[model samples]
Target: MKQSLTAMALCLTVWLSIPVAFAGPPHGGNPGRGGGGFFDSTNEYRDAVSLQDLQERRRQREERGFERLKQLKWQTGYTMPQHYRSDRYKVDYNYYQLPRPKHGQQWYKVNNDYLLIDDDNTIIQVH
Candidate 1:
């Protein structure tokens, strides 16, 4: 009876070890998702995403922003055109404070055109 119990325990141990052994990094291959279970495919994918393509994409975005500034629209109720003017909105010691306009008037500019927007998002003046 003791020999039978020992054999049963040994069988259970071997059964549990089978799955655990296969679950680890298979053979000499990496367990990472980027690799094909054995080979590193990261460099291949990284090279595919060329630097020239990324630079060109950034240049296009910059050009688009410059174009938007050049062509200021008569759009009212707009939250804000450019995020770079955030300094003007905030009271920072480093940035120059914009002079206050008439009561209840906030000046917003896209490019060279200055738009006077009121508190209620209404266009008061466009120059």
Candidate 2:
């Protein structure tokens, strides 16, 4: 009887502690809503856009990534930030921006690393 009681207590403890060991996302909603999510970061109103459209945008960006990066007017609206906390956009270049996110595949810098992000805010490629 004592052994059975101990086993039950142990099982209960493990069940309760499982959440702490592998906690879910903070928001507890869709895990891929913000940050490095499966959707677009610029898209403030996720309700308006359909999933198919978003997927299509990502595909287009991946296909035309090279052309878009080459045509970027780097000297125009882009400028090196005064301070950066993370090396998310590291690159060899001195100038860095917090990703002027656009509608298609865009090139960015994150700590000596060149990143190519798709419309879905997915890192398609990196250099």
Candidate 3:
């Protein structure tokens, strides 16, 4: 019975020591592994500032675009911007209650308004 108790005690001691023997570095495992030891506050702050700066720049760009659109006065006989001539801006005349464009002309949407432009990029009509 004493020998059996000694063997059981030895087994328990070995089982407990196994974890310590295979333990990671004293400062904990690699930070990338999320072992939780060291943290760089500066990096975190820089990342946050970078994200905020990107958002601010995006907002400013959108504001500038809106301002530019507002400043434009789509008058007849004036040529429309080349960007508005792309197929991406094309709209259906029937859906928007607009008149059918003649041959060589297409209906395009610029912001909230619709414009009828000819192949020459001329602003035929604005609605």
lDDT of 2: 0.56
lDDT of 1 by residue, 29-100 (tens): 564654345455664576567876898999999999878757757665654444534536433222334456
Name the runs in model 2 displaced over 4 angstroms.
Answer: 1-103
The worst-scoring run of ten residues by lDDT in candidate 2 lies at 76-85
Model 3 C-alpha lDDT per residue in residues 4-87, reported as the tens digit of each score: 999999999999999999987536646666554355455568779999999999999988987897688888888887656677
lDDT of model 2, residue 23: 67
* Residues 1-127, model 2: lDDT tens digits: 9999999999999999988999655445454655533354545455356676888899998768756554544332343332322345434333554445455656666444566555455565545
Model 3 gets an lDDT of 0.84
User: What Cα-based lDDT does every candidate model obtain?
Assistant: 0.62, 0.56, 0.84
Q: Judged by lDDT, which candidate is best?
A: 3
Which 10-residue window of candidate 3 scores lowest in summed lDDT?
34-43
Which of the predicted structures, 1 or 2, would earn the higher TM-score when compared with the native?
1
Instruction: Go through the candidates in order and give the C-alpha RMSD of each one to the true structure.
Output: 13.1, 18.5, 17.2
Candidate with better lDDT, 1 vs 2: 1
Give TM-scores for every candidate, taking all chains together and pairing residue i with residue i: 0.41, 0.21, 0.49
Q: Could you tell me the lDDT of residue 4 within candidate 2?
A: 100
